[model samples]
Target: MGNENSLREQKILSYTGFAAKANKIVYGKRGLRNYIRSFQRKKVILIPKDTGSRVKLDVIKHCQIFDVPYIELNYTKSDLAKTLGKQNISVVGITDENIIEGILKTIQ
Candidate 1:
């Protein structure tokens, strides 16, 4: 999932293995997280933690049109590599919402 095209679009998502790493580790902002959650299964859905060039056209369209910045973060998995295995991704999302949740939820 390490492609320049995906990197330009979203941050690489690292699998935060079995430790509920998303809500706890990555995200620390409540307001931002709640806002992002609202978009879930609605106007916008959180991209998988490892969204590569495989992103869908509609998601890409929304990200481009809305300027929402499709993003990810490999740190979540890296930090917990001993638990979740090593992630190949390098880039991850900024601490807005998606990455935060992924980090907290990603187990290790």
Candidate 2:
């Protein structure tokens, strides 16, 4: 079970890396808020476990209001940031349809 979980995490990390490279991901709290508000495309917001409760609540509320889906990752903010080659990323919104589909499929 542990090994399976690790593999899933690895796959998610790989997809996140690809999204970052393709410019399909919106980073930071402000960016995610703006993207979810203005964009009508299929997207999945990745909120790491280490994110502050207040920020997480606000993000979730926005997602609910906009009918967007979000995932609270088991990984921490630093882990996610390192995967995307960034620093101090609190939230991430993936805008690519293919990546969104791929991640949702993996989760289920």
Candidate 3:
């Protein structure tokens, strides 16, 4: 069971990396908010478990307004930063439907 959980986490990280490479992901609070407001594409927002309450609340509010789906991942900010090759990435928004689907599957 532990191995299965680790494999699932790896798969989620892999999808995050692929999305970053494909330029289908937006990081940071402002960037994600802008992407949500400006982009009409289907998106899913990933909020790390360790995100601050204010930022997480704001993100959830924006997502609600935009009717975008969001999920809280078991990973932390550092985990996401490492996976996406970015620094201090607390919020990640994925704009690609296929990649969103892949991530959703892994998380579920």
Which numbered prediction scores highest in lDDT against the true structure? 2
The full ranking of all candidates by TM-score, starting with the best, is 2, 3, 1
Q: For all the candidates, what are their Cα RMSDs to the real structure?
A: 11.0, 1.5, 2.2
Give candidate 2 misplaced runs (Cα > 4 Å). none
lDDT of 1 by residue, 2-28 (tens): 565444333223332322344322222
Total clashes for model 1:
24
> Is candidate 2 or 3 superior in lDDT?
2
Give the TM-score comparing model 2 with the true structure, all chains together.
0.89
Give lDDT per model, in order.
0.37, 0.87, 0.85
> What's the lDDT for residue 13 in model 2?
81
Residues 11-97 of candidate 3: C-alpha lDDT, one tens digit per residue = 877888999999888877678888778666677888889999999999999989988888777789999998888898899888778
Sort by lDDT, best first. 2, 3, 1
* Tens digit per residue, CA lDDT, model 2, 1-86: 88887777778888999999998889776788788987557788888889999999999999999998888888999999999899
Question: What are the runs in model 1 whose C-alpha is more than 4 Å off?
Answer: 1-20, 24-55, 71-108
After superposition, candidate 3 runs with Cα above 4 Å error = 1-8
